[model samples]
Target chain A: MKKVMSVLLIGLLSACASDTTKPTATAEDRSAAPAAAASAAVTSAVTNPNLNPILTDPKNILSKRSVYFDYDSYVVKNEYRSLVQAHAQYLRDNAGARVMLQGNADERGSREYNLALGQKRADSVRSAMTLSGAKESQIEAVSLGEEKPRATGHDEASWAENRRTDIRYQGE
Target chain B: MLMRSHQSSRHTLTLAFLLWLTSMPLQAALDIEIFGGGATQISIAITPFATEEKLKQSITAIVAADLQRTGLFRLVDSSGPALRDPRQIVYPDWKNRGADALLIGSTVMLPDGRVEIGFHLMDVAKQVQLFDHTITVPADRLRAVAHQIADIIYERLTGDVGVFSSRIAYVMKQGNKYALQVADADGFNAQSIIEYGEPIISPAWSPDGTQIAYVSFENKKPVVYVQTLATRARKAVANFKGSNSAPAWSPDGKKLAVVLSLQGGSQIFLINADGSGLQRLSQSSGIDTEPNFSPDGQSIIFTSDRGGSPQIYRMLVAGVASGTAERLTFEGSYNVSPHHSRDGKSFTFVHRNGARFNVAVQDLATRQVQLLTDSRFDESPSPAPNDRMILYATEVKGRGILAVVSSDGKTRQELSMQAGDIREPAWGPLPRVR
Candidate 1:
């Protein structure tokens, strides 16, 4: 229990350091292998509930991976700042970590336009992560456009849910 | 997952693919609904050619359907006076029935297991034969033969080339799978060229009508592929990073203009037929996509947001030309998918007015815009090879279906499938002489 508590404290301190300064995140992430192991531990917690605590706890900010946007708008909302920050901090702590950002849009306008809009959304998320100290090499942004939708409804309720940028870790 | 496991680079309706089709067949027949027509519809009466019923297919019926769908020809009553031959037709009797023109023919099977069809088009009031021809083909080519006869009649009466023999390509999404289909101009004998567990869109037929360039998302990202209709061999024409889509073929069929995002925001790039010689055509930091070449092969029209909203723009694509792209659309803030007519005098595109997106055409000389449809959502407006009608995709009752409109916007029709969203239509060029 003491060791676990020490690890949790270290994780919290590094997440804060990374969110504040890129150089500070690089400095603390000197142990890159162990930090990557920490990400794996967090992910494994999905299947084994007690393996990892903070992100997979179902109440943590890092638990959410989707950044929803307005219709025809790729601007990341104010409500998703901390959620993006948490993921950026996690990436900053793990030097070897890689992520693929899939951007999508609602099926309302021209598909080619939606594709470009979705790409803008992905690029926007990528900018947010890079600004918060995530390495540019560790992230890739791509647009799925309106090709794949989470909900098949033709109403606004479903359209709002589909206009989003999804964050996916490497090997997912 | 199993679908990709069987995914070969080339898929012909060949023997192997035919065997595989047993497990998955072409979805179902498409249903077409036609309404409205030209200002003055031509009244014509067609009688069954002698011994036409003995043959396997109804040649006259197919020809009549082909002509009727154009909204230019109205089928009058050819039922009176037992008119099986041109000599047997009484001009006064036909004139009383309101037929300006009459068509009669005969079909005979040869000893070599082939069929010969001879047709005649006569002016009922003038009492003279305007056209006559005989065409020979194997028994299986009856439908195409009928289309050819209809073309001859259409040309004689309308003073324009007929597109009855032309084909069309579109995408059909059924359940979780999507198919790229090719069918006759009347939506018959649909053949699934490719099927996968992903979305397919923007099917552009080659100018020669032998190949199709489309965007497929089977690789988890959109990649443009050019597939030969005959050999079914395909190659990824544009696989750049980000998204590669909205492929349009040059009129000469030597190059394709595709939208790519490798450098940043979506931009237009030109590539050769075999996917080589990549050249960035449009230099814009904002979104520029959906490139279509002029019929003369000198200029290209595309959709761009460089000037605030999405509007159509034209630029010289030939050698040593102006370095500026002139804006063409000013009325609508959003106008896209510009397809040049066969004559290059006008182009068809989708226009968004308030909440509804409709099909519209703009004359190049007059800069006049003509609204062609009132559908809530209309897309992918492609003009026929004859420059007479426009085929497009529109949503009806929340289901996507194919629709057609005459160049004058006087005639309208819709083609819907039993299941699946049929959309992304590209009117095929006239059948080549091959």
Candidate 2:
């Protein structure tokens, strides 16, 4: 009788240890699953293998806030694709998060024309966000035209800085 | 500043009396200062007018100032003797003084409280009388008479219609107060047409010089309003959702082409003068605004970014059924705010070249573009009624001021005020003489 009782006690202790160790192993995978899923859904292209820090670290790719364009062009360049894709993944991981994409232009054209150009640029960024996994309602795109220039200058370097799409988080 | 205030008070008193007598608002006379002139200006001499009784204003001084302000004529020293008659023979002396033309005049007060004025224009080289005219008017019409004489002499000499008798409407902002003011073409006799605390922009004169269309930002958003000069009666022509701005009058004064953002993006639309018929003139996913009607009223020119960059495009007024627009400007990546010349032969617009914005005109036939200004921020180019000069807004010492450039780009002048920033000057049509 004493041997049978000791056997039952050992069996129950092993079951408790297995249950505790299982959750500890799965916690890391749970934290990483959303970002992995988001990347997989966006494109079949190779992505950064170490995305955990990129998604959470303030000094990582997610911290980059602006996408710039060439003169009179709205096409997003290849250099900014990974940066935008990381942001898209972040937004998809956190559904409650909202962002505002403000498009700006250099003071080279008419006020109304600049306003339209800025709108197109913001829209282009919004399109990329939605295609990556973000919800349409989570983003708002607006144009500031040449009215709100980041660089108050009349040169190519200043203009290149002024013409940009800025991503802003909620309440910012 | 003190002198200007004193002059303005005196001008107000004069205008009040003139309004009571003629039942019309006499334009506030402006004082003009010439900045630059052509390389070879016509040299002319005008002797002091002989008057029986001491006149209030000097006829010779008024005429000389008017001609001098045009930058087309240089007033030679007429300090010799007052010649009331052209018969005073001193032809060799005047010719040797580098005088291409000479003018002499006289003013006589009649017994019935009227005045008789006579003037003569003569060719100094030919020693021939070019014009001799006499006019009788009320005692108060002396300034008007002088301007008419100046116009006649200017036309007879330069073969171009004078703008001395015309007026200009502009918005003057002092602190938070804005005044849509009309002054003489020389920037004198400024009288406020409307006063508001909000901003006023895009002042456009009707074809008949009796009305003005402008954008007012009173209700937190821009609204287009047309106000008659005589009655001061105003009606909001466009108060749609978003913004309504940049009003341009049709040639017949029957319609207005305006910019509205009713459907999310700025686009040009045409509204009847009475504010009834609303029709969209431009349809583009991109922004299309700043529409000016052609002289013939058969077509409209506006700035659009449909082709990825801002460019001037022309379309028929027959509506969107007339698909597509013919691009008019391709010299630069940015061209906007086009104003058609009175003759429809060319249009002036703001062009961007290497980050500098300047006024440029393109001839429709020759496809040649001429840069009219070299300023860094010149905009809102409005041609004079005679198309002899282009009035535009520019920044001087960080203050907005109006400037005029001759159509040939030879002469330039700045019309600045003692206080406040003035912008969006629309040169009105010539006043019809009764």
Candidate 3:
């Protein structure tokens, strides 16, 4: 009976300790590791070409179709080197083609701040396209802060897709 | 006995630690359980001299009404003290009547048709005088004199400066047309500033209080525009291709911060006052919006969801080039729309918890969060230049209404028009002349 009572007391004490323990697991440190691994896997499966929305879509023949930017950055994530090259090549192929890059903030921030973030996103896309092949006179950029949400729900899934710039060709 | 002594020692040590903990200043953390009790039971006694009954009755009632409208004090019936002189205030009589505060005054008519008014604040509990002052004004201006005195007494008790004289600017949308209206802080004195047949969003005031920057959808796409308050001159700041919105002015009036999304994503950028010398600030993949400069002009605090959720982030002015950023808010899943206090001591923002949205303020020194508004959906809390009052948009009667509340969240008063719905109010800075 004494041995059983001691074991029960130990079990209760351990349960209490676990309940009062401060969290050792944080969202970033835990979720970030898995997200990075998944992203790496995705990149490996799909090499550079398929991810280039500009090169594959012939609709982008005017160099005004797609703008590229850097990773984890809206300042024109730079890996779109060839993708921007294709757009610049298109702009060279068809001169006098004008496009506007609309930057959009995901529904993850205050509308005012998101508006500014979207502007920077658009500016980055314009810079990359201009550097690759598009002319400064042919491209315009603007930002729409989280006011116009592509996805209505407030979740990570929706937010990830909303932080982007749209390329609109000014069909004359 | 020895075991008992050991236990007693342990108890003493624990008691000592508790005392030390209590002595330390509680970090500004607040667990606010708001009481929705609509009104206060403050009763003020006004006893006037016999000769000035007509002027006293009208003036005192106006003063009492103003105090009552604030929902901070109550004016009690004091007809029993009729004909009492201001000099002969019986503090005990007011104390016996269960009065928290008493206002007694007398007016002396001058030969030149002017009047001299003397007022006193009697502390019923302490059975002594709290404050007293005398003013000389024309007899016709007696009501204004009474309001001035009420303003004085209100300021003394409440540490916050009064906003009884300030104004609010809001956008009222009716069908396809939108109008910019400015009115007294009390929703009176409504006057239209501009009326357009299209959508107008995000009205921002210049530091000098002479110009307003807004986004107008006149050309079928969002474009940034600025209008002068005096000449009504309108100029397009930027008409970029994709989106041009969310205009903010720096404190020095030299630069304007706007969101331009010509790139593939939206980011914060700075442009010269004339819309030149544009520079990009944030490079995060997540959407960053609502950029506001700290009063000191050293850093910018903006809303960013780069970390997978919307939160307030701080970056130095140099961060535009250096690319260094730090997260400022960690509590609650949602903390957005940050407006810094004029003194730089605190900032006001809206924090969302589940389905409920609240207007909250954060103390920079203590890192304490205080919710000022309690409603279903509250947004766009703009602080007065005094940093004592915040005007925000809230839902009422199934429509959006503009409401103002004190910074401490103790006194809340709704500012609305009986004619139409009003939302997205931006409290202008203190008048430069005033």
Candidate 4:
């Protein structure tokens, strides 16, 4: 009778311990699972590892706030592709996050033309992000033209800073 | 100790004298503030009054002081030429002295308690009276008569409406705050309208010149507010989720075009003067902002990047309702901050070429562009009501000053504050009632 009782107590203790350890193991797995799944998704999308460069840090984010053009050019550059891809991956992983992209320009020309140029910059970023798998619902874009500037100085350095799109997280 | 004290006192006195001399205009020393520039100089010769000797000490100096401050004419000194009556300007002698035009005026108090003033603008070269007028005003308005005379001379010479009688509304920054100050066009007699401890920007006067629309960052975010100048009454026009700025009044003063981001992205939104009847004008996957209504009110000229680069676009007011925009400018890589002249003959905007930025005027009918300013930082070129002059803000020696230049880029004048910076000066429309 004593042996049966001891056996029952050991079984109950072991069962409780196993149940507590299971959640800790699953929690660890849950956190690591998304990142692993994300890498796999990226890997599958592009077999070329070089093309699938992981944009891990904000330093790799586009240092330039704006990309200027010669008059009315709207073509995206080969250099900004990796930066755009990183932003796209951030949007895809977060799912429900919405961003407001504001485009701006240096003070020049008519207000209407600057507004159009600013719109093009924002649209370029939006299109690139969309092509990279960012949902359409996650991005809202606007042009400030020559009105709002990141730098107030009317020099080339300031103009370059003024002529780009700013990505802002809208709400939590 | 006494010698050292005397030395220090002398040094202080000398410093003060030098400071006053350097800070004041040359006319201020001559008891007149002549407009500073080289042009067809307009000279005025006032003969010493033979009668009313007691008032001569006061009236003569006051009249001369008033004329000089107009920045329109130079008072012929007692030593520069032979003494003659302003009425009887010897054209040959005046012309030889480099005076292209002349002004002669005198003041007399009538028996009926009124001051009667007579003034004449003589074309020294043509040897003809360009204009002569006699105004009988109350004694209190004697100085105003002097300004009227200055205005007459200014108009006759420049062929453009004189802004000497106009007023200026500016934002005076103090510490981290700003005040809306309304003063004479020469930056005097300024009084604060609203003394809020926040950054106030973009003060624009209504068409009637009674109210001002500006962006005040009172609530941590910039919001458009309209304040009546006469009453100090203010109302918030719009507060969008993001930047709500560049409040431009339509020519008729019935509507305001503003940039509102409440609709997900910043777009041009039209609202009534009293902040009602809000309507969205344009929508793009890109930014659409800085909307200026055409003088005809049939369309709106705004800056957008719908075609992949910031460019000017014109959308008919009715067509914006139908959803269409036509491209306007293609010459430059950058063009922004467009304002139409009162006559609708031309439009002035900031244009960037290579590394330089300047205020350029484009004749709307011909599409011909003329550079109005050569400065790299020339932006916000607001045309005066006469369409003959433009007032723009530019950085001079790292300080911003409001500069006025003839529409043809002939005459240029820089108006700077004693401290701080002056920017975004939208010259108010001519007074409606006055």
DockQ each: 0.12, 0.04, 0.10, 0.04
- Please write out the lDDT profile of model 1 over residues B1-434, one tens digit for every residue: 00100111221222432232232222112222234553478988887777776777778766876776677876776653324467887789879977899998888899998998888899998999999888899998987898888898999999988998899999988887678899888766677887765688889999998999988776456778888888666777777656778899988899998888766778888889787788888888788888899988888998988898889999988543233699999996889878888899988988998988889999999999999888689988899998888988888677788877777776676765557888889999998772
Winner by lDDT: 1
CAPRI verdict on model 4?
Answer: incorrect
| Candidate 3: Cα lDDT at A82 | 64
Give me the displacement of residue B207 in model 4, in angstroms: 1.1
Off by over 4 Å in 3: A1-110, A113-172, B1-93, B97-100, B103-150, B238-242, B262-264, B274-277, B432-434
Clashes in model 2: which pairs? Answer: B28-B189, B29-B188, B29-B189, B30-B187, B30-B188, B30-B189
**If both were scored by lDDT, which would come out higher, candidate 1 or candidate 4?**
1
What would the per-residue lDDT of candidate 3 be over residues B1-434, giving only the tens digit for each residue?
00000011111222322232233233112111112223444545655433555452345544554454454564444655443344566667776655788877777778887888777777767757788887888876665566577666677655556555556778777654467776655455566666654456778888877888877654334667777777656666655445667788889978877765544455678877677677888777656667788887888887877787678888887735434678878888878888888888888888996777789999877889887766777888888866766888876766667876756676665655665657768887655542
How would you class the docking of model 2? incorrect
Tens-digit lDDT track of model 1 for A89-161: 9889877656667789888778877888788888899889999999877776777888899987989999998
Better candidate by DockQ, 1 or 3: 1
lDDT of 2: 0.72
Docking class of 3: incorrect
- TM, every model: 0.82, 0.69, 0.63, 0.64
RMSD for each of the candidates: 12.8, 19.2, 20.6, 17.5
